[model samples]
Target: MTNAHDHRADLTASFEPMRHFMILQSESDVRVLIRRLLLSCLLIALIAQLVQSQDSEINEIQVGDYVRFELRGNTYQGPVIQATTNGRLLIVDVSVDDRKSRRQVKREACVRLTPAEMNSVFKPVPPASKSEPIELTMPTLAEPGEGEEIALTNEQLPSVDVSSPTVLDWSGFQAGKRRINKVPFDADPDLPYVLDISTGTVVYSVASDHSTDIFVSTDRPSDYRLVRIKNHTVRIADTLPQHGVALGLIRDETDHDKGLCVITGLSTGQPRVASAWSLPKQKVRPLYCHYRRLLPDGSVVCVYENTLRVFDGRDGRLCWHCPVPAFFEPAVSQGGRWLAIAANGRLFVVEASTGRCAGSIPNLGKETMQPCFSPDGKMLAVYGENRMVITRINDGRVVLDHQANVDLAPFGGESLWTAPAVLVTPGGYLMDLRKNMLVWKYQLPADVNEWMGAPESGWIPIINDDWLSFVRIPHQDVTQLSAAVDQNALVAIQAGDSLRIEVEIKDDVRGDVDAFKANLTKALESSGYRQDISAEALLKAEVVRAAERTDHYINFGTGKTESITYRPFGARVTVVHRGEELWSANQAGNLNYHIAGGLQRAAKQLEQPPANLFQTMQLPRRFLSKKFQNGLGKSSVSIDGVK
Candidate 1:
C-alpha cells in the first residue's frame, strides 16, 4: 500500500470501467473527487477497523490496488473492484472468469494486498466454442430459493363472477377543455401541486389577495366563495417533485375553517408540523413529497428524503418515523396502516407505526415506479416500464402481473364490506373484479389524447394549455377491473382476420421475463409489426436461445489453485415463424448476469447481425418478419397459433 502521492498514473488502464474515484469522509459527509480520466467515480472510504465478511475497512487505496479482508477467521485478497455512492458498500469481483460474479462487503473488511500475492495468479477464463469443448467439472445451478427477487403473483385470482357494469361510451361523455375557475393562479403558481383530489367539492382561496375559496365534494367545482385567514409573506423553495395520488389531499373538516393538511419547509427547512395552513398556515409542502396521505386520526404521513414521517394532522406534529432508502415517492394506504415504497429497484413494505421493514419484492425488473396501496391496505399495485404488478401486503404475494402499460393507472380497490366492483382501466373498461371480466368497455374519444382521473371527484379531468375541463362520470359508471398483465399489442389484420403470437420464455436465461418481453416488443414494433391483423392468420414467433444449450463450462483444478476457468457466458436470439423455422442465427463469454447481458447481445444481433453470420442466415439484416402480404405488398393476415 502506498500514499495518495505515490498512486500509479497507469492505474486508469485497468480501472477504466470505474469512471473515477472520490474520497469521502467515513460518514460520507461530502466527497472530494479524484478523476481517473473520465471514468465513473468510485467512492473510497478509509475505515478505522476491519470486521467480518459482511463489513470491512479498506486502505487509502486507488484503482488496481490489491486488497485483503478477513472474514470468519480467514483472509482473502483480491484487486479492488469499485466503491458505491456513499462508500459504505464495496463491490469486489472474486472470480476473474466471471466479471459479473462479485460480492458486496462493507469498507471495514478491506486491506492492501501483499506484493507476492499480486504477482501470483493463474490464467483467465477463455472463450468456449463447439469446435473445442473444454470438459471440466462445474457446479450445477442451485434451485431458486424460497426467496425470489421478483415474486409477484404467479396465477390470477380465483375468477369472480361480476355482474355487468354500466358503461359510459366515450362519445356519450361529452368531453371539452374549460377552466372551472380563474384566479391570478394562487400562491407559488409556478410550482403547482402534483395533484388535487376532491370527493366532489374542493376548498380554494379566492383572489382577494387575502382570502381562500371552497367547493365541497357534494358541490360543483365552478361555485366558489371567499374566507378570511392569516397569510405568510414568505417565498419558500421546493424540495421534491409531486406524484402518487394514492396519498390524496390531507383535509380536516374538524377545523371547520376548511383546514387543508400539509407539511412546510423548503430546501434548508425541516418539515415541522403536518397540517393545513393559510398565509400563516400551510398546506402540503414540497420539502415533504413523492406522496402524502392523511390518516383517519388526523395525522399525515409524508416522504422527506430517505425517511417516512407521520405528522399529527391537527397541528402537523411529527409522530413515528420509518427509515428507508430515498426512492420513487412512497405511498400510504387509504387506511394509513401500511406504507409502500421502492428502493434498489424493488418494492418494500413498511409498517408505518413501527418503521419495521415487512418484506421486499424482487425481480419486478431492475427499476420500479410509483407503487400504490389498495384502499383496504391489503393489496398493492406497482408500476414499471415493461411490467406492472399488484401484490398482497401481508406476504408480499403478487396479485397480478402483466406487460407494463403506462396508460393503465391503479386508482382504487374494493373495501372489506363492499363488492369488488370498481377499477380504472384506461382501455375503456367497466370491469368487475368479482366476475374477473369486463362488464362493459369503451374506447377513449379520438379528440381526447390523454385521460387522468380527478383525485376524488368522479370527474375525469383534462387540460390543454390554458383550458381545463371536468368530465363528469357517475359513481356507477366507475368499475374496478381485476389486475392482469395487459399484454395487448396492436395486431395488423383485416376486418375478417384474427391473430395470436405465442410468448415462449426459454428459461428466461436472462432472468427478467419483463425485459425480454419489452425487448421483443420493441424489436417487433420497430420492425413495423404490431398492426391490426385478421382472425384467419397464424403468426407465431418463438423467443429462444441461439444454441439451445450451454456453451459455457468451468473447472476448479484444486484447492491449491485460486483461479476458475470458464468460457464466455452470453445470450442468443431465435425468432421462429409457425412450425416452420427461419434459418438465421447467434454468439456469451467473459461475463456475468448471463441472461440479462445475453438478451441485450441477442437483441443487438437481431437489429444488426454480424457480417459473417448474415451470409449464412440469408436474410437481409431484418429484425422481424410479416406474414400474408396484401395486393399492395402490405402484411395482411389472420393469426391464431402458439399461445
Candidate 2:
C-alpha cells in the first residue's frame, strides 16, 4: 500500500505545475487588454481638444469691434454693429470718402483692425511738430493754365468815364434793368473779387478809385485799394501797399460792414492777414498762408507748409494746429462746423473747433481744388482735373466719383452749390449730388460776352459791351420745356417711328457680347427709344482697338499697380423707311475701362437721332439747332447751345 501511495503523489505533483502555468497566462492576457482600451480613449480625447481650439479661432470676432473684410473684390473696414447667432454673417458700418453706409459681410472674411489703425481713424490729429520738415509729393499751388490773350484794338475797348462810379438799384438791376440805369466802371478784369448776391455788394481791388485801370502795372504800380460798390455808389473800402496782393475776401453774411481779407506780400510771397476790417475800423491780425478761409464764426483757418492752424478772430490766438503732409486750400463748412483739406495725398475732414479728424480717404486725385460744401453742410463736393467726388459729411462714404463732361476747375468764378445741385463753371452743367447725374446745362444769352452766375439765387450778371445786366433764370419755363421735349420724344417712339433700334455687335470684337447687348438695350430704353429685333433701324458697333495699360503709384507708403483695360470702338446707326435710308448717325465711343462700358457709351451716343429728325417731328425752334438737338436726346441737356 505504501508503494502505491508514493506513485500517486509523484503524479499529483506534476499536474500541479501545469495548472499553475495556465493561471499565470490568463492573468497576463487580462492586463494586456486593459492597456489597449486606455490608449484608444486617450487618442480620442486628444482629437476632440484640437477640434475645439480650431473652432474658437474661427469665431473669435465680437460685436463693437472694428474689422476689415473683403467683399466682391473690394475691401471695407468698419465696426461690427451686429452678428448672427451662428457667427457666419455680420453687419458693418462702413464710412468711405466721408460718406456713411451699412453693409453685411461674412465673419470668416473679416480681420480685426490693429491698434495703430484704430488710432488713425478715431484719434485726434497730432499737434504740428515744428522740428519736422514739410513733405510735399506734388506742387503746392494748382494754378489755372493761362488762356490765350486776345488783343483788342482801342476801337473794341469800351470808352467809359473813370471819375464816376455808379451802381443801379439792386431790385431794378435784378429785374433786368427795367428801371435802373446801366452803371459803368473801369476795373481790372484779372483781379479776383467777391460778389455778395444776398447784399448786392461787389468787392474788388483797384489801383485807384478814380483811375480806369484796364491793366495792372508791373513796375511803379500804384497802391491797390479795396472798393465796395453798393446802391449806385462806389466807396474806397481799404488801401494796401503796392506789393500787397489780395488772396481771398470774405464778407460777413450777417453784417455787410464786417469783412476779412487775406493778403500776401509780393516781395516775400508770404501770406498774412492784412487786417480785419469793420468798415472804417481796421484791426491788424497775425496769420499767414495764402490758402486761408474765414469761418462764419469769425475764426480764420490757414494751411501752411505742413501745418493747419486756426486762429480766434477776436483775440487772434492760435486755437489749434494740426500736422499735415502738404498744403492745400482748406474748405470750411457753411456754419464753420467742419473743415476739409487735402494732406498726405488724402482728403481729411476735421472738426473746425477741436481739430479732431473725423475721417480721411486716399486717392483724392492729383489736383484737388477747394472743396465746396452743400448748402446744408451734409454733402461735400470736390473737383479735380474734371473729376468730381461728392461725399457725405456725417460718415465718410463716397457717393459719387464721376468723370464730368464739363470743366470743374474754377475760372475766376465761383462754383455755385445749392443742396443736391452744383453748377460747374465755364460749362454751366448743373449736377445732382445725391442722384450723381447731370441735371441740365444752362445757356447764356447771345448778347452776353462774359458772365458770372449765381445759380442759387437764379440770377446771373451778364457782361456786355455796353452794360452789365442781370437776368433771372426761367426755372418754370425750363421745366415745362423739358417735359414737353420728353413727351414729344416718347410720342415719336411709341408711334413705331424709326427710333426703334436693334443692336448688333461684330463677332470680331473679343469681349462679352451678351453683356454688351443687354447694356445697349437698357440704354436705348432709357433714352426714349425702343429696341426690337425686327426693327428697320440697325445700330452696329465694332471694336477699333483693345489695349491694357498699367499705372504704378505709391499708395500709403506701399507701391501698387493699377491695371487699366480699355476698348475703343465706333458705332453707326442707320434707320430705313420704305427701303430708303431715312436717318443715319456715326459716333465714336468714349474711352471706357470695360468692353461692356464701351458698348454702353456707344449705345447712348447712337440713341440721339439726327438733327433733321427733330425738324421732321416739328419740335421746338431751339431744337432745330444741332447743338440743342443733341442735348435733347442725351441724359444731360445742353442749354447754352454748345457745339
Candidate 3:
C-alpha cells in the first residue's frame, strides 16, 4: 500500500471520499455552520434542479402545509396547492421574501424540518387546504445531530397517484453528468491522448498553485490530486523508463531538441533521471514522443516528426536513430518487426531489426495519406481522399483497392486507415485488410445525426447527445445492421407500494449494499415512482451477480504498481402485476454497469420511455452540438471524413 503502484491493489483501503460539507471561514461568525449547510445543499441538474433535503421530515410534508424549500439555489416558502392539471402532484404557491408576488414551485423540492429547528419567534402565514385548513403545529420531533445519516424505512415513504405529472414530465434529463466521464482531460475527446500505455492511465495538465501540474486520477476523475507541476511543456513516453518509473521529456518554449528529460517514480514521485545530458543540436520542432515500442532486447523505438530514435528501455540511452524522409508518420508492425514508410507517392517497406529497405510500392497515388499496418503486420492500408488501398508488406502487391465515400475517415473524423489495410467509411463497407473483403457496412438513415468507426478493432463507440451506445462491427446484411439491439432498455412500470431490492453478491464479491439500495431508491423516486404500501403490484429487483475484474499494468512513472478494478454486474427487475408476471428485463454487464448507475439509469428509463420519431427530433443534441449544426461531420468519428 506504501507504493503508489501497489496502492491500486488495495483500492478498498484507498477509496476515501472527500468531505461533503465545506468548512466556512467567516470574519464575524454568528452562523457559519448554518450558512455552510444552506450553501452546500445545492446540486445541479440539466433540466431542472430537483431539490432534495437531508432531513427525514420531507416525508411528512403534506398537502395544505406551508413549508420552506430550496429551488435551484434560492429558498421559497409557501402553501402546498394542487396542480393546474389532474393526475399531477401538489405544487406550491411560494411567496419569496424579496418578490412582492408569488411563484409556483413543484412540491418535490420542498424541505421539512423537525421540531428542534423550529423557531418560536416565527408564525405560519397560511396553509393551502381543501374544505378546512389545519393549524400549523411545531416542536413535533427532537433535534438530530449534525452529519447524521437518516435511514428511511418502508413505513416513512409517502404514496401518490402513479399518473401524477411529476412522473410524466417531458423534460429529458441529461444522465451522463451523473456517470463517470470517459473523455480525456485537457484535450479534445477525439485526439490521440497522452497515455502511460503500460497502465493506460491518461495524463493531464491542469493549472494549480500558479503552475501547470501533471497527474492522473486515482479512480474517477473527481478523485484526482496534485502529483507534480511542470512549468514548461512536458512529454510523457508510452513505456516506463525503469520499473515503476515514468519518463517525461521537457523542453523550453523555443522548441529545442536540446532540452533535458526527467524520470519520475510512480510510487515515490522522486526524480530517477540521475544525469542531465546536454542534448545535441538536432530537430528544432518540439518533439512529441509517439508510437513508443519496446523491442525484444530492452530497446525502445519512439517517433518524433521525421526521426525514429531507439533508446534503452531500462535507462535513457540512445541505441540507434533512423531517418524518415519527407516526415510523413510511418506505420510500424505491432512488435516492431517491420516499418512501412510512405515517402512521396511510393510506400517503402523497411526491416525494423536492421533499418534496411526491403521493398517498395511505387505510385500509390499523387496524394496518399494514413498508412497503417495490419494486425499481423503483413499488410499496409493507405487512405486517400476517396480511395483506400491495401498492400502486402512482404512484397509490393495491391491486395485491395477500393473506392471510399468522400466522408470516410479512419482514426477520427477523416477517412483514415482503421487498422492495417482495413478501412471504414460512411455509407461504405468495412474493409478487412487481412482477407481483402468487406466484413460489414451500413448506410445511415437520413434522420441519423452522426456515425463513425472507433478504431481498427471490430467495435464502435457511439454517442448521441447525452446517450452512449456501443456495437460490434461486420454487419454484412440489413438485418444485422438495422436490427433492434437495445442493450440499455429500461421498462419501469407503475410499480408496487415499495421497491424490494434483493442483492445476491458472491461470497468473494465486494460492494456496498446499503448504498446501492439507497441510490436505486433515489432513481426510482426521480422517475415518478411513489411508494404505496396498499398497492397490489411490487417492483422486485434481484442482483443475480456481482463480479469484478482487476487488471495490473506498469505503475506509471511511480514505482507504485497501479491496477484497475472493474465492477461488472447484472440484475433483473420484474413487474408483478397482481402476482402475475408482467415483464422482466435483465441488466447487461460491462465496465459501465456500476450498481448505483444501473439503478439510476433504469429509473430514468422508466420515467422517460422510448421517444417516438417526432419526440426524438425535439430532443437536444447538447453533447454533439448546442444548436443545429449544418456541418457534414457532426459525430465524433465522421465516416464521411473527419474534419
- Our model 3 lands, by Cα RMSD against the true structure, at 31.3
TM-score of each: 0.36, 0.36, 0.35
Q: What are the per-residue Cα lDDT tens digits for candidate 3 across 138-214?
A: 11111111211111112211121111111111122111111113222332121112122222233333332223344
User: What is the clash tally of candidate 2?
Assistant: 10
Give the poorly placed runs of model 1, Cα more than 4 Å off: 1-200, 205-224, 228-288, 304-307, 320-327, 344-347, 353-367, 404-422, 425-643
Predicted candidate 2 versus true structure: per-residue lDDT over 355-420, tens digit per residue: 656565443543335565555556666776555677665455676765433455533223456434
Candidate 1 all-Cα RMSD: 30.4
* Model 1 weakest lDDT span, ten residues long: 629-638
Model 3 misplaced stretches (Cα beyond 4 Å): 1-200, 207-212, 229-232, 237-247, 254-306, 313-316, 344-346, 351-368, 405-479, 482-634, 637-643
Model 3 is weakest, by summed lDDT over 10 consecutive residues, at 613-622
Tens digits of lDDT, candidate 1, 267-357: 0011122223321113443343443444433445554455556554433345566444444455555434555556555566655554545
How does model 1 fare in lDDT?
0.33
